[model samples]
Target: MITSLDHLVLTVADIDATIAFYTQALGMTHAPFTVADGSTRHALRFGESKINLHVSGAEFEPKAQNPTAGSADLCFLTDRPLADWQRHLAAHGTRIEEGPVPRSGATGPLISLYVRDPDGNLIEISAPLQP
Candidate 1:
């Protein structure tokens, strides 16, 4: 049986820039050893889950790869509610696509917001499930 999620992989063009975005902007720390892997891997700590970033190549641009922008979506859990996430994103000028809506799924009702990284990969920030 599946216990919990370990991490999610994200392909980026600029590994160093992505690392800085996660570490500086998103408040994630770079895991050691990954830096020496040569693929420019980095992991951001999210509770017990980690967000893994992999450098594909110089020509690897997310926007170019994901035109529909629906290949994959990543979610982040925050202690604050949807309103807080909205404010934080606005303060940082993060793009919001579809979100903060009560989504119907296995997890029940959850509020979510969407944003993209510097590489133009769609990422989501979500508040804990609430009725």
Candidate 2:
């Protein structure tokens, strides 16, 4: 059984653009590392989680059967309120596809905002509802 998520790989069209979006818009940190083959690869770090970047058609060995962009729907928890997220996204020129709508989260009810990344991945940023 999995204890907790360590990292996930994202098949992206442009690594630099993806990095810029996550770092600037989402406040994640960029971490570039050298692999076993001595090739440099990039990742976006937030909290204890990281998303590894792999260019489409040049993915590492043992990748997903159909590694495609724009196919993933990911949700992330935040301490900030939904209103603050709206302004932040606007300031960064990132569009919100939908919501401050209510949805069920892993723990309980949440208020979430949906946005798209450079690769068109659906990213839901949620804040847990207070009692």
Candidate 3:
């Protein structure tokens, strides 16, 4: 049985670009750290979770069979409304790939805004619709 997720590995083309996009658009913080092999790696921290940035082919070891960019589609819950996220994304020069449309999330009714990260990963920002 699996518990809650700790982190997700993101295979990216450029680490700096990924950092810039996530931090500037999503308000995540850059958390760079050294691995056991003395190699430096970067992560984007939000709330209690983080995404470990793994440069394609330069990943630590025992990685995916084929690591590629723009492969992740992750949804993050937000307290703010869809309009607020639209403005926020616009301020950061992020294009909304899709909607402020209605959808069903794990908790129930949701309003989501889609944006692409530097690697073209689909990042969905959602807010649970109040009952």
Candidate 4:
């Protein structure tokens, strides 16, 4: 059985812009590592999770059947308050597509805000509802 997600890949249109958005807008850390073919690849790290980046047409082996940008809708849980996140996002000039609306998370109730990354991927940042 699967325990947890080690990492996931995102087929990005532009790696640099994706990195900048995730890093500056979302406050994730950017790390570059060498692949088996000795080429450098980028990843964004947050908590214990990481998202690897691959160019649109230049994906690594064993990739998704249709690795297209803007096709993903990812939700991330945050301990910080939604208000704080909103301010932070505003400071970064990131637009919130939706509000702190109620939603069901993988574990329990959650309030989430939606935003779009540079690649147009729907990014949901949520905080658990303290019922």
The candidate maximizing lDDT is 2
Looking at candidate 1, the ten consecutive residues that score lowest on lDDT are 60-69
RMSD of each: 4.8, 0.8, 1.0, 0.8
lDDT string for model 4 (15-85, tens) is 98999999998989999999789988899999999999989999988999999988989999999999999
Model 3 lDDT per residue over 13-131, tens place: 99989999899899999999998989788999998899998997688677888889999999999988889889989988899989998989986999999999988899999999999
lDDT of each: 0.65, 0.94, 0.90, 0.93
Which residue runs of candidate 3 sit more than 4 Å off their true CA positions?
none
The better-scoring model by lDDT among 1 and 2 is 2
Error of 1 at 91 (Å): 1.8
Clashing pairs in 1: 100-112
The CA root-mean-square deviation of candidate 2, after full C-alpha superposition on the true structure, stands at 0.8
Give per-residue CA lDDT, model 2, range 1-131, as digits (tens): 97899999999998899999999999999999998999998999999999998899899888999999778899999999899999999999999999989999988999999999998999999999999
In order of listing, the candidates' clash counts read 1, 0, 0, 0
Q: Estimate each model's TM-score.
A: 0.71, 0.97, 0.95, 0.97
